[model samples]
Target: MIELSRVPDQEMWSISFGGDCANVAIYCARLGLETHFMSATGQDPYSASMRAFLTAEGVCDDLLLVHHDRLPGLYAIQTDASGERTFTYWRDSSAARGFHEVEGSAQALQNASEADVFYLSGITLSLFDRNYRAQIAELARSVRARGGHVAFDGNYRARGWADPAAAREAVASMAGHCSIALPTFDDERALHGDTHEDQAIRRWHDAGVDLVVLKVGAEGAVVSSKDGTAERVPIAQPRDAYDTTGAGDSFNAGFLSAYLAGATALEAAAAGNRLAGEVVMHPGAIIPAEAMPV
Candidate 1:
């Protein structure tokens, strides 16, 4: 979707390619991962731009499927005085929502089982109907069975679901097959009304997720595992954030980058916090390549 924000002298807009999983893939590639992104998009100017952007960012788009007759979705961001942004979307019939129906989707998903890790988010699930949700679950199961790690982020949006119960059910089912569960405390509270972080962690662990990384805003992130070990990774330093848009998403990229590179979960959480701290200081979900920590 397109992003618009305010500057000192006037309001301006910036458009870029952004979807949750795609966002992670971009950051991971920049962070030295051989990241491949798979998705469906229309054959439009924006879709063309997206493909080019993904390529220029060092992300592999070989699995991106093009729909002949549709348009990509668009969203607008409006920020408050506090820099917190609200969204307005026009994606009900976006070509990406029909990803399962895209010709190469099944093959691309099947091929994902061979990867070292597979990542997805609740927003990805919200694009599908009930049947496709089950298809995604089966794909996650396949990845796990083949000894590949499945990572999940419960990036929930109420507008994405038909009801709270279905959202909860679907998220739990996906969580059951994930080895790494990255969830935001605010989303968990909104979904299950859990009052504490530990409660949310237990729920994720109970669903068969072995490693849990729960992000709690500026408090940093909490890392836990099924082995009954847990630790809090506080922010390394205070940040003057301009936009909080992709903080959690980039956190996932940084944490996964560290974890897959053999860092302990606590270390990964700290890495995530460090990257997120940097991301929030920028105006969008992504920062310039030079802005990344050394």
Candidate 2:
């Protein structure tokens, strides 16, 4: 999508390519992973520019299918007083919504399954129809069944779901298939009303997640594994954060980068916090490439 983040008070807009999965793909590529993105794009100026942006960031765009009828998707972010954001999307009739309906969609999904890590989110599921969601679910399960890591984030947004029931179903499916599950406490509370954090944790574990990390803003992340081990990891050094957009996406990328490099789960969570902290210190979905930690 063509991302336009409104600069509060200044009435300025910073335009770029943005989306949760795309953000993760960029961060993963920068963190030394071979990440390929699969989606549909319209043959429009915005799509052209977004593709160029992805290429510039070293994320592969060969998997994108071109659509002639629909235009590209666009979203604008409105940041609040506390660096939180409210998003409004023009994606309902977007070309990318039919990504899995394209002829090459299954081939793309099957090809991506060979990856060492298969990463996706609830948003990805929400974008597609029932059949496509099934394809995604099956792909994730296949990845895990083959001993590959399937990383999932229930980056739930009620607005994206057709209804709360659909959200529950998709999120539950991903939770059941992921090897590493990353979820926010607020999202869990909104979706399931789990009184205690452990309730959410237990739910994911029971659903088949071998490792789960519950992100509690400021309080840091609580990490748990199927072996009954759990602990809280503090955030990395705080920064003068300005925007919280893409913080979770970057955290997942950083954590995956560290974890793929053989770090312990707790160490990976620390890595996630470190990157997430850095991400919030900047505006928009992506920080300036020069500002990224080495």
Candidate 3:
């Protein structure tokens, strides 16, 4: 959501290294976690710049994929005078689509299996081929099998999936494999056509996830655990939003940052609200490092 696209009258232009996983990985690195980003980039100057930017953000480069023939994806944030944004993207033939290249596949998969917690999104899944998707899913299952957490976000972009049903099926299958599921209520409603937030939560719970965070935009969010416990935590304050692109992504980052540090679901959701609230006040998916709270 924080990437680049050409639009009239949005005159303010800036470049930031962004993606759902990148935003979360940046947040994790800033939060003092050992973070690794698994994705491919082009051999172009833009990709070189992206590598430098991510390094400066504290993300380890060891698993970051590099490809000679492709280019990084791009997106545009079309904002009204009021700062509300709608996006148009150009990622269809990007290098990210070939993410499971063997150069680092085994190592990256091993890292996923060994991480205390592994995070990914629907866009992340869309990058892989069908076989690669299965491979990634198996790595997530391996992480959980070893008593680690596997967190998933159903950040479905209609433009990314071949069809709504395919997105639903892929996301649903991935949900069944996750230990913690974080999904935006609107995305869930659109994808699964589940009328109520509870039904969406139930779908994941029934699939065996131990915890779920249902992000309901302005109404706040619901945090549910396997024991049938559900807690509604309100947003800390309302806002005249600057950008909503990565609100949910950063929310997951903050929530997982606290959770991995031993916070309760409610406490983590509160952390999520606090972070997302701040992110929407900024102009992009990623805010300045100095602006972050320690």
Tens-digit lDDT track for model 1 on 1-294?
A: 444445434656767657678879989999899988878889988888888888899999887888887688877666666656677788898888877778889898888768888899999889888788898899899888888899999999999999999899889879888999999999999999999999999999988999999999989998999987778899989686777888899999999999999998898889899899998887767788999987
Badly placed stretches (over 4 Å) of model 1 are none
Model 3 per-residue lDDT at 270: 88
lDDT of 3 by residue, 1-294 (tens): 228733334556766668889999998888888998878888888899988888898999887888777788888776666656688888877777766653776787787688878889998887766777888889888988888889999888888888898887777678777999999988888888889989988888999899999999876789998887788999878777767878898889999999989898899898888888888877778888777755
* Lowest lDDT block of 10, candidate 2: 234-243
Measured against the true structure, the TM-scores of the candidates, in listed sequence, are 0.97, 0.96, 0.94
lDDT of candidates 1 onward, in order: 0.86, 0.86, 0.83
Of candidate 3, the 10-residue stretch with the lowest lDDT total is 1-10
Encode model 2's per-residue lDDT on 129-205: one tens digit a residue: 77678888889888888889998889889989879899998787667778999898888998898889999999999
Candidate order by lDDT, decreasing, is 1, 2, 3
In the order shown, what is each candidate's alpha-carbon RMSD? 1.2, 1.4, 2.0
With a 3 Å backbone cut-off (N, CA, C), the pairs that clash in candidate 3 are 4-75
Q: How many clashing residue pairs, candidate 3?
A: 1
Measured with C-alpha atoms, the lDDT of residue 228 in candidate 3 is: 75
Give model 3's TM-score versus the native structure. Answer: 0.94
Ranking by TM-score: 1, 2, 3
Q: In candidate 3, residue 230 scores what lDDT?
A: 80
